[model samples]
Target: MIMSTIFPEADVTEGLKSAMRLYASGVTVITAGQGAGRRGLTATAFTSVTMDPPTVLVCVNRNGQAHDAIVENGHFCVNVLCEEARDVAESFAGMTGKTGADQFEGFEWIETRVGAPAYAFAQAAVACKLTQTLETASHSIFIGEVCEAATNPDRTPLLHFNRGFHAIGALK
Candidate 1:
C-alpha cells in the first residue's frame, strides 16, 4: 500500500517525495566514456524493459553530468552495486568530489563492446547502446539495447532507501 494518510494534502509533493524515499531500490553505477574520458553516476532508476529485444532503461536527472555524457557517447554500462560497494555508489554519487581517473582508483574496470567502462567486481553488469531518450519534466529516460550482461553468483545487491544505503540480509 502507498500509505496515503501520510501525504494527504494538495501541496504535498515534497512530502510525497519524502515518502517515496522509503521504497528501496537496487543501486547501479551507470558509466560512459568519450572525448570527456569517463563520466558516471550512481542511480536507482534502472529497469529491464523487454527480453526479446534485450532492452533496459535508466532515468537520469537532466542536470547531472553523466546525463549528457551518455548522450554524447551513445553507450553506457550499468554496474549493479554489490552490498559491499556502498562506498563505490557514494563515490559515483558525487559524495567524494573526485572526478576522472581519480575516481576509478583501485576498482578493476575494462572497456566493453560499447566502449563504456564495466566494473570487474559488480554484482551485475549490463552494457548497452542508446536506442531512445524520453524527456520528462525533471529527468530523461534513456532506453538502451543491451549488448552484453552478466551477474555474479555470490554477491548481494546494494539497495538505496530513505536517503541511505541498506545492507542485504540473507533470508531465513
Candidate 2:
C-alpha cells in the first residue's frame, strides 16, 4: 500500500530520512522525572492517538535516558516548544555539554502532579501517565493517557522541516 514515486537509488537510511525530512512536524521535548533523575529528549514524533480517553503516543530511542525515566517514573510531560526554545531543544538533544541535572539548569519549570517537568515557556505542555509501550527496532512507542494539558495561546509553536526549526506562522 506504499504510494510514493521516489525510489531509493542510494542507502535506505539516508533515503528514508531525506524523505521524512520533507515533512514539517511539531517539536516537543519529552520530559520525565525531576532533580538528578530529570531527563528529556527532543522529539518530533509525537501525536494524538485518540480523544475519548485522551491518549497520545511518543517514540523514543530505546537506549535514551529519557525513555528509561519515563518507564521508571510512569509519567511524562510533552512540552511543545516555541521558536525561541531552539536552544532548549538542542540542550535536551545533547548538543550542549549538559546532561541530566545540568541540562535543566536555567529553565523555570513547573513540576506536574505526575512528577514530570513542564516548561513554563512551552507553547503547550501535556502531562500524561504512561499506559502502554511497544518496542520496535531501535525505539519504543510509548502510549500515554493524558492527565492534563495546558497551552499558551499567545505563543507560536516551533516546527521542524528540512532539519531546521521554523515558527508556525509562516504558513498559517
Candidate 3:
C-alpha cells in the first residue's frame, strides 16, 4: 500500500478536523505566570519530544495570550487534565472567557518549583523550563525541559475528540 498516493487537502478544515477526531489525545491546561499575574489556555497539542533530559513540546497559537505570557516568562506548567476536569477545560477554552482570578475561581491550585500556578486536581503536572521557542506560520512550538513532575494516584485523563471532550467508556 502506497500511503502517499491517498490525496486530500482541498478543504483542509474538514480534513484537519476529521484527522484530529480519529486521534484522541489527552487534554492539558498550559499555564504561564509569576507572582499575581497568570494566564492559561486549554491545549491538546502537547507531546514528549526527548527522553535523555526529559523534554516535551507544546504548540500554542501565535496570537494567544498564553503564548505571549510564556514568551516573556520563559516558563510554563502543563497540567494534565483528569476525566473529571471537563468544566476546567471549558473554562480555560474560552467557554466563559473569564480573566485573572475569575478564570481560576473555585479551582484548587499550587505553585510549581518555578512558581507557575498549576492545577492540583490534575492527574499529573509537568513543570517545564522553557528551552526554546520556534515560530511557525500560525503557531509557536515551545520546547521545555521537565523541571518537576508529580502525579495523582487516582485520576484518568480528559481526552479531546471530534470537537468535544470525551471520557472513555467501559470496555466490553
Candidate 4:
C-alpha cells in the first residue's frame, strides 16, 4: 500500500526566514570588481560544492549592489570572517550605512589573483573565477572555480545564528 500526504497553503516566507535564523553558518563577505567599481556584501549563503575542481557557490540577492558587479567583473572572493571581524561584517551588511567602496574603508585589503578585493585579516580567502550562474526567484546562485586561496589557521571563524554572532567551542 502507498500513502499520500496533503499540505497546507500557508505562505512559508516568514517561517522559512525564522527557521534559517536557528541555523548557524559561518559569515563571509563576497567581494568583486576592482578600483572604484569594487563591491561587496556580507553573506552566509555560501558553500563548497566540489573538491576535485575546487568549486564553491554563493547566493546573492538580485537587488544587492554587489550582484551586478560580480556578474560583470567575472570574479569574486569569499572572505571568511574571523571572530574579530564583526565590524567588517556589519559594514558590509549595511548596518554602518556604507555603500559601494565606502564599506571597504578602515580595513586592510588585498587584491586577489583573480582581481577581487579580499579582506586582509580574513580567516580564509578563496578567490575564484566565475564559472556559472543560476537565477532563482529572488537570488542568483554564482558558481565559481577557485583560482587562489589563502588561510590563516590561527583565526577562529565568526558565525551567525539566532539573529546574532557566535563563536564555536569544542563540545568535549
Model 3 score (lDDT): 0.86
lDDT of 4 by residue, 1-172 (tens): 6534333457466667777887888999999999889999999999999999999999999998899999999999999999999999999999999999999999999999999999999999999999999999999999999999999989999998887777786211
lDDT of 3 by residue, 10-120 (tens): 777776666777677889999988655788899999989999899999999988888888888889999999989999998889898697546777788898997678898
Model 4: weakest 10-residue lDDT segment is 2-11
**Candidate 2 C-alpha lDDT tens digits along 1-172:** 7766555676778778878988999899999998899999999999999999999999999898998999999999999999889889888878889988688888889999889999999999999999999999999999999999999988877888887778876643
In model 1, what lDDT does residue 31 have? 91
- Each candidate: how many clashes? 0, 0, 0, 0
TM-scores, all candidates, are 0.90, 0.91, 0.89, 0.91
Backbone steric clashes in candidate 1, count: 0
RMSD of 4: 4.4
Model 1 bad stretches (over 4 Å):
1-5, 34-36, 170-172
Q: What is the C-alpha lDDT of each candidate?
A: 0.87, 0.90, 0.86, 0.92
Clashing pairs in 3: none
Q: How much does each candidate deviate from the true structure in C-alpha RMSD?
A: 2.6, 3.1, 3.1, 4.4
TM-score, prediction 1:
0.90
Over 4 Å off, model 2: 1-5, 169-172
Q: Over the stretch 1-172, how does candidate 1's per-residue lDDT look in tens digits?
A: 7665665587599787886797788999999885347888999989999999999999999897788889988998999999888888988987888975466666788788998898898999999999999999999999999999988969988888888887776321
Ordering by lDDT: 4, 2, 1, 3
Ranking by TM-score: 4, 2, 1, 3
Error of 2 at 113 (Å): 1.1
